[model samples]
Target: MERLTLSVTIDRPIGYDHHGTIYPINYGYVAGVIGGDGEAQDVYVLTEDDKPLESFTGELIAVVHRGDDVETKWVVTDFDVSYTADEIMATVRFMEQYFKSTIEMVD
Candidate 1:
C-alpha cells in the first residue's frame, strides 16, 4: 500500500474537549505542510490510548474531503495500525459532524 508519512504537533492531546465535545484521540498538524487553506495542514491521530501526546509520526490512511471548507482533514495512525473509512468517520464525527465531508480511503 502507498502511504504518506506525517510528523504532527499534537495540539489537542487526549482528554481535551472543545465546546463540550470531547476529543477521543490526538489531533494536530504537520508543522510546515500547507493545505488548501494556505496554512499548516491539520491532522487527526486515531488511537485507543487516552494518554496525551506532544508529537507523533504516523501513516496517512485516509482523507476526509470537506465539501464546505477549503481544508481537508487527513487521517493518520500508527505505522502498523489500520482503520477503515467508516472507522475514521466514526472517530472524528465530533467535529467533522460540523462539516459536509466524504471519506476517501487511502492505501
Candidate 2:
C-alpha cells in the first residue's frame, strides 16, 4: 500500500479516559477524510514523545481493520520506525481488545 501523510486532530489525548479506560496514546481524526463509518477517519498517533498533543502530522503506517465494525482506525507516526503487527496490536489493545481487528501495514 502507498503511504499517505495525514494531519490528525487529537480529541483523545494521552491519559484521556473513555468511561473507565485511560488512553495511552493520542487518538484523533482526520478532518476531511471520511471512513466506512461515515465519519472523519479515526487515527491512533504513535510517537516516542509520550506527551499529549492537539494535532499531529505523520505518515500512515498501518490500518486497524475491524471485522465487526464499520470504522477502521489508522496508525501513523512521525519517526522513521517500523512496527510488527503484534507490536502495533499490543500498543493499541487498550481499546482494540474489544473489537475483532487486524493490522495491515502500508508497506
Best by the TM-score measure: 2
Question: Clash number for model 1?
Answer: 0
Give the Å error, residue 89, model 1.
0.4
Q: After superposition, how far is residue 58 of candidate 2 from its true place, in Å?
A: 0.6
Worst ten-residue run, lDDT, model 2? 78-87
Superposition error at 35 for model 1 (Å): 1.3
Highest lDDT among the candidates is held by which one? Answer: 2
Please give, for residues 1-107, the per-residue lDDT of candidate 2 as tens digits: 67898899999999999999999999999999999989999999999889999999999999999999999999999857788889899999999999999999998
lDDT (Cα, tens digit) per residue for candidate 1, span 12-68: 988888878778789999988898999888999986677889999888988889999
| Runs off by more than 4 Å, candidate 2 | none
Clashing residue pair totals per candidate (backbone < 3 A): 0, 0
Colliding pairs, model 2: none
Worst 10 residues of 1 by lDDT: 1-10
